[model samples]
Target: MASSMLAPAVGDIAKEFRASDKAALAGQTSFVCMLGIGPLFLAPMSETFGRRKVFVVNSAMFTLLQIPTALSPNIASFIAFRALSGFFGSVGVANGGGSIFDMFDVHERAPVLGFYLTAPLVAPSIGPLLGSVIVRSLDWRWIFWCMCMLAAFVTTFIYFFLYETNPVAILQARKSELQKKHPDVEYEVEGASDESIPKKIMNASDLTCSPENGTRAVKILTTQPIVLILSSYQALIFASMYSLFATYTDIWSQPPYNFTTIQTGLAFLGPVVGFVTMSTLVILYIDSIYNYVARKNDDDGLPEYRLVFANIGAVLLPISLFMFGWTVEMGLAWPVPLVATVLFGASQVSIFNPVQTYYIDAYAKHAASALAAGAFLRSMIGGVVPLFVGQMCVFPSTSTRRF
Candidate 1:
C-alpha cells in the first residue's frame, strides 16, 4: 500500500515543483500503470526464480528504492524510481498464489487466495486514508519512509520461511545428485550437457517440468481463454475500486455530505469495512466449499469447480452496483450504500480467490504463463479507468443516468 501511494504522493510534490501535470501522477488508476505492471514482472519471475527469492529480493529493492526516491529532487527521477519500486513490489501479486501453494495443498487454497487478494483491494483505499493524515501534518516525503519501515517484516519472512516450492527444480536437484552418486543412472532429463556449474544451475532455474516438454511460454499465454475471462473480471472489479477512489473527494464533498478534506478521505472507511469483512468470509468458508465439492465428486476435482463460486459472485456485482447507486442517489440512509459496498467488497474477494486459485489449479505446470496472461490485462484495466472518474462523478450525464 505504501509503495503504491508513493508515486501519486510524489507527483503531488512534482506539481509544486512545476515538473509535470496531473497526467504524470499515473500510478494505480488502471491495470497498466507503473504499479500495475508490478504483477506482470512478478508472474514471469516467480516461474524462473521461485516465489520466495523473488519476494525477498524484490521487496528489499522496493523498500530501498524508497530511500533514493526520498531524495529525488526532480519529477522524472521520482517517477523512474517509483516505477522501479512498484515493479519490484509486485511480488505480492505475482507470487502470492505460489506462496499459498507452497504451504497448502489444493484442498486449502480457497481461503489463502482470499487472504492474498485483500491487500491489493485494501491498499489503494488505505494508502490514501493514512497518507492524507501524514501528508497533511507531516509531509509527502514520509510516505516513502513509512514504506521502508513496513517492508522489513515482508523481507524477513521471505528469508525465513518462503522456501523453494517449484516442483521441477526440486526434482532436478535430486536427479543431479543421483547421477553423480551412480554415474550410470539413466534418466530422460534434457540439457544433460557438460556445462559449467552456473549454466547447470541456470538450466534448473529455467524450470520446466521436464525438458522434452520444451515449448515457448509465449504460445501458452496467448491461447488461454480462461485467463482472458478471469483477467477481464479482475480488471473490471479493480477498475470499480480505483474509480471510486479517483474521485472520492468530489463525490462526497457535495451538498449532502459536505465532508472536509479529512472527512472525505475518511469516507473510505466504509469500503475498508467491505474489504476486511469479505476477506474474513473467504478465509473462513471458501475452502470448506472447495473440499465438499471435490469430495462429492470422488476427490477428482477439475479447476472448473472453483467457478461455481465465481458464477454467484458475478450475479452479485450488478445488484450491489444498482443498490449502491440507488440508495446514494435517493438520499436513503447512508448505511444502505455502506452496507452495499461491504457486500460488493465481499463479492469481489469471493470471486478473486476462486479465480486465482483455479488459475493455479488449471496450470500447475505453467502457472507463470497463466498468471502473467491475466496480470497483463487486469492491470491495464485497473490503471486506465481512474483517469476519468473525477469527471464521471460531476458529469450530469453519468451521475443522473438511471439503471
Candidate 2:
C-alpha cells in the first residue's frame, strides 16, 4: 500500500520539492526495489529464528520508519526512508507462504492461499484510491502518516495474536526447554546449533542465525529449476501489473479525460472489482479442482495441478492488454478501457494464486525461501518497470502498444 500510494501525488510532490520527474517517481520505485531485495535475506532468516519474531520485529521497524518518511525534508530523504520501510515491511511477503504451508495440507491449502495472496494483489489498486482522497484533502506527507498509523495497528495485532508456526523453530524451542529441564539427557534439534545452554542464551545469534540455515534460501533459489521457472513467470506478471499502475495516472488525467486526483484514484476500482470477483471464484473452486484432480491420480497431487487456472490467466492477459491499449489509444469512453483493467485484475489473481500455491506444494518445507526467491525477482522487475513506464508513455501508439 505504501509502495504506490503516492502515485496520485507525484506531481504535487515534484512541485513542492522542485524535483525531477525521475526523482518523484523514485518515491514509488525505491520502496518497491527494497521490497524485492529484503525478502531474499529475511525469508531465510525466518527459517532460522522463526517467522513470528521476524514478522514482529521487522513490522515494528517498518512502522517506525514511516515517521521519518512522513517528515522527510527532501526527496532524497523521502526516498531513503521509504526504501528502508519497504525492506522491513516485506516480512509478510517473505514468509506468508511458508506459514500457510506449515498449517495446511495440499487439498486444504488452495482456498486459504488464494485468500492470503489477495492482500498483495489488491492492496496496490486500493492504495492509489485512498491516496488520491488523502492527497486531494490533505498534504502528501499525510499519506505516510496514515501508513504509520495503519502499520502500528497491524504490528500490534501481530505481536499480540500471531504465534510461532515454523516446525523447525518450534522443535528447537522444545529442545531448549527439555535440555534445561533434564540436564542429564541429550536434547538435540536438527538444523539447530549444539551450543551449551548458557552459550545459547548469551548468544542468540548462534542458535538463530546459523550459517548453513541462513544460506538455504539462496541455495534453493539458485539450484532448483521449478523455483526458477515459476519465479520468472511470477516476476513477469508483477512487472506488467506495476507497469500499468505506473502509467495509470498519466493515461486518465490527461487531455480528453481531464480527471481529478480523486477520480483518477477511483479509476483503480476497475482492477479492484476484477480482483475481488476472481478472488471469490478462486477461493470457492481452486481447492475443489485440486482435490478432484488428485482423486483422479490415485489421491496423489502433483504441484502442476495448481496450473489449471494459470492457463486461463495467460489467455486473458494478452487480450486484456491489447484491449486496454487500443481502446485508450482510440480515446474511447473511459468505461471501455476500464473493462480492460478489470480483465487484467482478474487475470492477475488467477495466475498469482495458483503459482504461489504451486510454490508451497513443490517446496513445502522451504516454502518461505521459495516464495522469497520469486518475490525478489517479481519486485525487482515490478520496481524497475515503473521507472521506464513514464518514458514509454511518450512514444507513439505503435511503440506504446508493444508495452
Candidate 3:
C-alpha cells in the first residue's frame, strides 16, 4: 500500500519539491525496492527469531518511520523515509505464508491463503484510490499521516494478538523450559542431541542466530528451478501491474477522459471489485478442487494441482491487457477500459493465490524462505518498471505490445 499510495499525488509532490518527473517517481521506487529487499533478510530472520518477534519489532519501526515520511521536506528525504518504512513494513509479506503453513494442513491451505493474500494483492489498488481522495481534499502529506494512523493501529493489533508460529522456535522454547525445571537432566530439541552443558548452550545459540538460516531464501532462489521459473513469471506480471498503476493518473487526468481526481480514484473500483469477487470465489472452491484432484490421484495432492486456476489467469491476462490497451488507445468509453481492468484484477488473484499456495506446499518447512524468494524478484521488477512507464506511455501501442 505504501509503495503506490503517493502515486496519485506525484504531480503535486513534484511541484512542491521542485522535482523532475523521474525524481518524483523515485518516491514510489525507493519504497518498493526496499520492500523486495527486506524479505531477503527478514524472512530468514523470522525463521531464526520466530515470526511473532519479527512482526512486532518490524511493525513498530514501520509505524515510527511514517512520521518522518509525513514530514519530509524534500523528495530525497521523502524517498529515504519511504524506503526505510518499506523495509520494516515487509514483515507480513516476508513471513505470512510460512506462518499460515505452520497453522494449516495442505488440504486446508488454499482458502485460508486466498483470504490472507487479499491484503497485499488488493491493497495496492486501493492505496491510489484513497490517495487521490486525500490529495484532493487535504495536503499530499496527509496521505502519510493517514498511513501512520493505520500502521499504528495494525502495530497494536499485531502486538496484542499475534503469536509465535514457528514449530522449531516453539520446540526450542519448550526444551529451554524443561531444562530450567530440571537442571540436572539434559534436554534436546528434535534434531539435536544431548551433550555437555557448555556445548548445549553453544548449539542453542547457533540454532537461533545461524548465518545459514539468514541466507536460506537467497540460496533457494538461486538453486531451485521451480522457484526460479515461477518467480520470474510472477515478476513479469508484477512489473506490468505497477507500470499500469504508475500510468493511471497520466491516462485518466488528460483530455480524452478528463476525469476528476475522485472519479479517477473511483475508476479503481473496477479492479477492487474484481479482486474481491475472484478472491471470494477462489476461497470457496480452491480447497474443493485440490481435494477432488487428490482423490483422483489416490489421495496424493501434488503442488501442480494448485496451478489449475493459474491456467485461467494465464488465458485472461493477455486478453485483458490487449483489451485495456486497445480500448484506451482507440479513445473508447471510460467504462470499456475499466472493464478491462476488472478482468486484469481477476487474473492477478487467480495467478497469485495458486503460485503462493504451491510455494507453501512444496516447501512446507521453508515456506517463508520460498515466498521471500518469489517476492524479491517480483517486487524488484515491479518497483523498477514503473520508473520507465512514462517513457513507455509515449508510444502506447508499442508499450502495450512490449508488455
Candidate 4:
C-alpha cells in the first residue's frame, strides 16, 4: 500500500519540489529497492526467532517509519524515509510464504494461497486508486498518514490474535515452560533454547548474511533452474506492471483524457476489478484442478501441475500488454486501455499465484529464503524499470508500445 501511494502523487511531487519526472519517480524506485534488500536481513530473523514476533516488531517499525515520511521536509528526506518504510514493510513480503507453508499442507495451499497471495498483487493497483483519491482530496503527505493508520490497525490485530506458528519457536517456548516446572529433570532439547536479543541478532546475521548463506542464496539463484526461470518471469511481469502504475498519470492527466486526480486514481479500478474477478475464479477452482490433476497422476500431486494457470497467464499477459500498448499509442478510446489493464491484472494474478505455490511446494523447508531470492530479483527489476520509463516518455518510439 505504501508502494502504491506515490504513483498518483508523482506529478504533484514533481511540481512541489520542481523536480524532473525521473527525479520524482525515484521515490517509487528507491522504496522498491529497499523492499528487496531489507528482507535479506529481516527474514532470517523469523527463522531464528518466531514469525509472529518478527511480524509484530517489524510491523510496528514499519508503522512508525511512516510518520517521518509524512513529516519529511524535503524530497531527499522523503525518499530516504520512504526507503526505510519499504525496508520495514518487506517483513510480510519476505516471510509470508513461509508462514503459509507453516500453516497448511500442499493440497490445502492451492485455494488458500491463491487467496493469500492475491493481496500483494492487488495492493499495488489498489494503492494507486486510493492514492488518487487521497491526493485529489488532500495533500500528498496524507497518503503516508493514511498508510500509518492502516498499518497501526493491522499491527494491533496481529499482536492480539496472531500466535507463534513456527514449530521451532513453539517448541522452544514449551521447553522453557517444562524446564521451569520441573527443575529436577535436566531438559536439554537440541536447538530449542531462547537466546538474548543481541545473541539472536548476531547469530541470525551470521547464519543468513554471512558468506556461507549469502553464497547459498546466490547458489540457489544460479543452480536452481526453476528459481531462475520463475523469478525472472515474475521480475519481468512486476517490472511491466510497475511501469504502467508509475506512468498512467502521464497518459491520463493529459490531452485526450484530461482526467482529474481522482479520475486518474479511479482509473486503477479497472485493474483492481480484473484482479479480484480472476482471483475469485482461482479460489473457486484451483483446489479442484489440483485435486483432479493429482488423481490423474495416481493421487500424487506434482509441482508441475501448478503450471497450467501459468501457461494461461503467459498467453494472456502478452495479449493484454499488446492491447494496452497499441490502444494508448494509437489514440484509441480510453476504455479500451482500461479493459486491457483488467486483462493484465488478471494474467498477473494467474501467473503469480501458481508460480509461487509451485515454489513453496518445491522448496517447503526453505520457502522463506527461496521466496526472498525471488523477491530480491523481482523488486530489483521493479526498481530499475521505472527509472527508464521517464526516459521512454521523451521518445515515444522507445516506449512500452515498441514491445
Model 4: runs farther than 4 Å from truth?
190-197, 207-218, 394-403
Tens-digit lDDT track of model 1 for 228-265 = 76788888987787666666555565645566656755
- Please, what is the TM-score per model? 0.81, 0.92, 0.92, 0.93
Candidate 4 lDDT over residue span 1-403, tens digit each: 7787789888788788788767878888888988887767666777778799989998999999989988877788888988888888999887898898999998788788888888888888889888888887898889989999999999999999989878888888888799899988776656554568787677666644353233345456668998998989999999998998888888887655678888888898888887898899888888788778889889688887877788778988999999987788766668999999999999998999888888888887567777777888899898889888766764143233332
Estimate the Cα RMSD of every predicted model relative to the unseen true structure.
4.6, 3.7, 4.1, 3.0
In angstroms, give how far residue 97 of model 4 lies from its true place: 1.4
Residues 1-403 of candidate 3 have per-residue lDDT tens digits of 8878898999999999999878988988888888888887788777766789889999999999989998998988988998899899888889999999999998788899999998887899999999998999998999999999999999999989998898877887888899899999986676434456555334433434343555567778888999999999999998888899888987887757889999888887777887898899889988888888889889678988898888888998999999998988877778999999999999999999899999999988888889998999898998998887778675344234322
Q: Model 2 TM-score?
A: 0.92
lDDT of each: 0.65, 0.84, 0.85, 0.82
Clashing pairs in 2: none
Model 4 earns a TM-score of 0.93
Candidate 2 or 1, higher TM-score: 2
- Runs in model 3 deviating more than 4 A are 191-211, 395-403
Which has the better TM-score: candidate 1, or candidate 4?
4
Scanning candidate 4 in windows of ten residues, the lowest lDDT window is 394-403
Q: Candidate 2: which stretches are off by over 4 Å?
A: 195-211, 395-403
How many clashes (backbone atoms < 3 Å, residues ≥3 apart in a chain or on different chains) does model 3 have?
Answer: 0
